[model samples]
Target: MLNRKSFGFDWGQFITGILFLIAAFVVMRYPLATLKTVTFIFAVVAIIRGIAILAGYSTLRQLTGKLAWVSLLMGIFDLVIGV
Candidate 1:
């Protein structure tokens, strides 16, 4: 016989596992769509990161001297690529 501590009905884990299984099935059936969605999210994040880096350019410059210019360019490139 199992003890209550080890064999109780864990509703939270059960629901999470079920949802994970559903996601797995969908991913298997429509891999391209999932990839596209994930890519789009990454692009949005890149754009946000670019803006963030640009906003902090002065501090970055103070810390890294001339190397900051490379970061500024990278930020601009990110914004362009994301769009």
Candidate 2:
């Protein structure tokens, strides 16, 4: 079943691919800057994940018994590492 109305160029993918190529060039030209950028992105993600885990603590507590406190600890750890 070839749907004639369902085919078109993926502009979003094209733009993303182009942007990635440019980013690769920049990274190659400036390794230190790239490292910093990547580090910052990871830290932010980790911090957000930690916060989410902490927020769901009650549910986790019910499921994991005494081990739920570990989520709290990990969340704080994420905030510290992010900062």
Candidate 3:
């Protein structure tokens, strides 16, 4: 039975998977490298994502919407964890 409803996948998952692979390889290969560099990148990413989520909240009217809420929560969580 084909319902009228539909679901979509996010491109972010693929990008994140690729990034994780790259990060793992880089970290493994350069274990002796400065930790500050990795921490800096993590911080930058978290900050940027947090800002993006905050901006999106204005356009996201429905708190029940999964994408809106998930994005906002993930952004805040990432920022906290990153810091």
Candidate 4:
């Protein structure tokens, strides 16, 4: 039998999603005012996400061997686009 841990709520991801929703709502509410701000925010988010993916390279590699390199490359692309 496969060993599986109990499924549980991930509060951190949930809270982060909620915060992103709130920010999106605020940006949508004042589109004109937040136009540039939203772009900057997205760029920063992309950069952070890229860094996070890169940081988890080892775990990914362990799971998928050579396939994991694709994710690493994607992360690098994201960083470049963000910058």
Which candidate number has the best lDDT? Answer: 4
Please identify model 4 stretches exceeding 4 Å from their true place.
Answer: 1-19
Listed per candidate, the RMSD to the true structure in angstroms reads 14.1, 10.7, 4.9, 3.2
lDDT of each: 0.72, 0.72, 0.64, 0.75
Model 1 spans with C-alpha error above 4 angstroms: 1-32
**Per-residue lDDT tens digits of candidate 3, residues 1-83?**
33737645544444555555666777888887637556765665666666656676756746446567777787788778667
Per-model TM-score versus the true fold: 0.57, 0.59, 0.48, 0.71
Where's the lowest-lDDT run of ten residues in candidate 4? Answer: 10-19
TM-score of 2: 0.59
TM-score of 1: 0.57
TM-score of 4: 0.71
| Model 3 CA deviation exceeding 4 Å by range | 1-17, 62-83
Two-way TM-score contest, 1 vs 2, winner:
2
Ranking by TM-score: 4, 2, 1, 3
Clashes of each: 0, 0, 0, 0
Candidate 2 residue-wise lDDT, 1-83, digit = tens = 44567766755345545655666776888887997765755566666666776777888888779998888898889888878
Report the C-alpha lDDT of model 4 over 6-77, residue by residue, as the tens digit.
756755345547657766987889878676766776676667767877887888899789899999998898
